[model samples]
Target chain A: MSNSTAFSRARFAALIACFAATSPALAQPSTVGFDQISAGDTAWMLSSTALVLLMTIPGLALFYAGMVRKKNVLGTALQSFAITALITVLWVVVGYSLAFTPGSAFIGSLDRFLLEGMVYLKSSSQLSVSHIAPTIPESVFVMFQLTFAIITPALITGAFAERMRFGSMMVFMALWSLLVYVPVAHWVWEPGGWLAAMGALDFAGGTVVHINAGAAGLVCAWMLGPRSNFGKDAFLPYNLALTLTGASLLWVGWFGFNAGSAVAADGRAGMAMLVTQVAAATAALVWMAVEWLTRSRVTLLGACSGAVAGLVAITPASGFVNVVGALSIGLAAGLFCFWGATGLKRLLRADDSLDVFGIHGIGGLVGAILTGVFADKAIGGVDSHLGVQALGAFATLIYSGVVSFLILLLIRSTMGLRVTPDQERGGVDLALHSEQII
Target chain B: MVHDDKFPIAAQLFIRLKRSPGRVIDVTWMLENELYALEVLKVARGADAESAELAARYETLLRNRKPGATAAPQQPTAFARTSSFMAEPEPVPAEVGRHYVGSLR
Candidate 1:
């Protein structure tokens, strides 16, 4: 038997080999075979994929549905569901290849086009695994990342909720997913990504998901313009109960989102789960307190939004931060997101209908920057620079914003981005989808 | 409060009425009397040439409303008659202004 010191040296050598194997090439099929894949990690990843997917379908769907007027509830909810279907198909086709496979630092190669090289040959007992996650089957890793892809663009639908044409929305999201979402996912998550090379520490997509979606959401809000009589109308939500339920679902599903980023069922993943809970709970309480202090009453919406804000803010830091870091991040997320949704919303005057930019955008920024400040190297096994984090966050924001604007502009000039005023007056459910709550 | 089915029109009228410089308009009444509400909305939205005068006339009638008054003889209310600012016959009658105020509790 080997001595303890020799065992340690061997483990270090194995770690180096694993790191070397992950170095970006064409994601070079797989030297890691089926037997090598960890069953535990694969099981967790499969469950996490399902959990993350849940965050989009009924979770985001109901969250958005409850916020819209009675006439628009169906249309609003449909956006999330539709994006889920759309991105699922798109991710399988070319999106996965262009995002994950290594090529240029700016974008990925198409070696895995149509998931071509990904194989599961039971006869030979050989299966493919992604270089990024050699411990799990590539199929599970692909599915896990696909959930992230689905939710990112779906998040933007909240900004232009009551106004967009369904066909135009579908078109815009498809294009935005390809043009804006794909490259940014490559830039941040893919090992060959420019941001990754710059030592940006995004444990779970602070820049890639939240900032990217937030910027696109802001642009959508601006381009779609405000809902009719936006500033002057009450715009009461259809049902707070549904919103609360959806928020609860989101809160539960976020464990998969943050913890699953660890790609392993280890101590790190456990720490991520703990911090996520701490941050979300802290932020929820802080938001209600602020609302109670300022408005003399706490609102369910404020609490839910605060919880989501905390979740968003802590996402990038979840794999990197400790409990104290989570508390600070949660506190800042609550206070800043409240102001973002109210004061900054009024100041921006973009009519981001559902406060997407206010909460997700501002929350993402706070989280991304704070990750640099609070990242514990002991936990993450990496140190992060504040300037590098800001660079990654801002770069994603600008890239997503500009590309989204161009895509909207193109769609607008061709098919028109909004329904006519008459159609809008009739409610999108009846006018757009020919369905209503009755 | 407006019914869900009629909320779209009610919301439009509410916004238009709120923006127009005047006393608070009874959105519930306007929703109940939708056709006349559209006319009021057109004036409130400044779509009419004499919107200012029309709005003032409407506000005066709304202000003088007497709740719980049964329908009376077809007597012209103060706002129904024309003044220097008006040419067309206004729709305001005493009964039109007398909308019910339901219990809040």
Candidate 2:
């Protein structure tokens, strides 16, 4: 065998050994039976699932909606809602299988397509093994994860807004979810996937969600050329109030996003929730401070954006680091993202429109790389996984960027990337819907 | 020229002036003719009175004066001959001032 192949095999063996060594023993049946699950845990999980769904449906949707010009508000909001609905159906049909089903080392097969042979009544199945809370029904876990799948592609839409055709967006989102998002999610989260087999642990979705979505967003932004008014006129956000509200919802919903990854109502989940809050708070303050020192004012919009950067940064490491690690990550994310959103984006000349790549993509990368440096075994039960984490992160970045670029090119060649200049100036809402925003 | 009654302020002012016997007909006619000429010039040129006055003064100066030796603006010299002619301000009657002051109070 080639050296790389042998190395992969050895790494896979080490992962299996590690899992076997640390695996918790199956609890024996008590006289009280499986009814011992705390009511608090069930309540928290149920609420968290709703919060995560909220993050995509209205949180991200309205956030992006308010960022675009007034003419495109309804179109942006409608597209987000549509993607949420579409992904929910797709996840039930085939997305879940490709992401979570048991298969080879690369990807899962179509055994669970259309959710065939999957019973909702049963609490335990092959699918349940992937979750920390095996007692919960696999259907619940699938629904919770489907929200993540929905938001990842929705995040990319912000990069190419105000110009892309609605039909092309639908096709691109469907393909991206299937090819890019699913494969990466599997590699990071699935037991048999290559990255997981290499001992990479993403507590939430630092690599899988933020990095994967951010890279794709950057590629899409580049492929869909700058807006017609770019550099010639100002493209300020139309409504800061709407963006503020959306950002606040994102902040609240992120607890569910990070803590819910634990899949159990345990000490680990509690720590994850605490660290996520601390990081986000610190990052918001730090970002506001930077803007004040540099720009002579503390803008509400800046604080909100900083909070999101913190959330993105802490996503991968929330489960692995202590409060100090969370604080440091937050500070770095605040400063780096301010630079990315303002200075770097200005230099690059790509109109990311909403800073999707700057905040999500760059923040996710920072979080993923730092997770290697700060991951402590005492806190998260992740030990000596730094090298594997770096490999997983780099692999995600390359795959996502390249695949996303190719997909964008294909879409551009076949259906065209940007709308006509007239259509864009008139607004996508009117162009596509034949109706004005009320 | 006949007076138009549509503009009461102008008609009243003209009637009051006509009743004042001490008013000079030659000077009144000259002023009236000059006012008519100014109005015509204003309409034709689409220029306000301020601009028209500046243009008239510039034309008069150009027609009557010689070029300066240095090709610069002509400087007023004490040795130059001066015309005694001067423009006068319009006068208001004592009763008119009293009535105007009464209206203000």
Q: Indicate which candidate wins on lDDT.
A: 1
Q: Which 10-residue span in candidate 2 chain A carries the lowest summed lDDT?
A: A24-33
Q: Highest DockQ among the candidates is held by which one? A: 1
Off by over 4 Å in 2: A1-42, A122-132, B1-105
Q: Write the per-residue lDDT of candidate 1 for residues B38-105, one digit (tens) a residue.
A: 45655564743444445555445444556763322352332342122133222334432221011000
Tens-place lDDT per residue, model 2, A311-423, is 99999998999999899999999988888787777777787877888889889978888888888899887564566878888789899999998988898889987889868
| iRMSD, model 2, in Å | 30.1
In candidate 2 the C-alpha lDDT for residue A313 amounts to 95
- Please, what is the TM-score per model? 0.78, 0.74
Docking class of 2: incorrect
> lDDT at A276 for candidate 2?
95
Model 1 chain A worst lDDT run, 10 consecutive residues: A14-23
Q: Which candidate is the best by TM-score?
A: 1
True contacts kept of each: 0.00, 0.00
Clashes of 1: 0
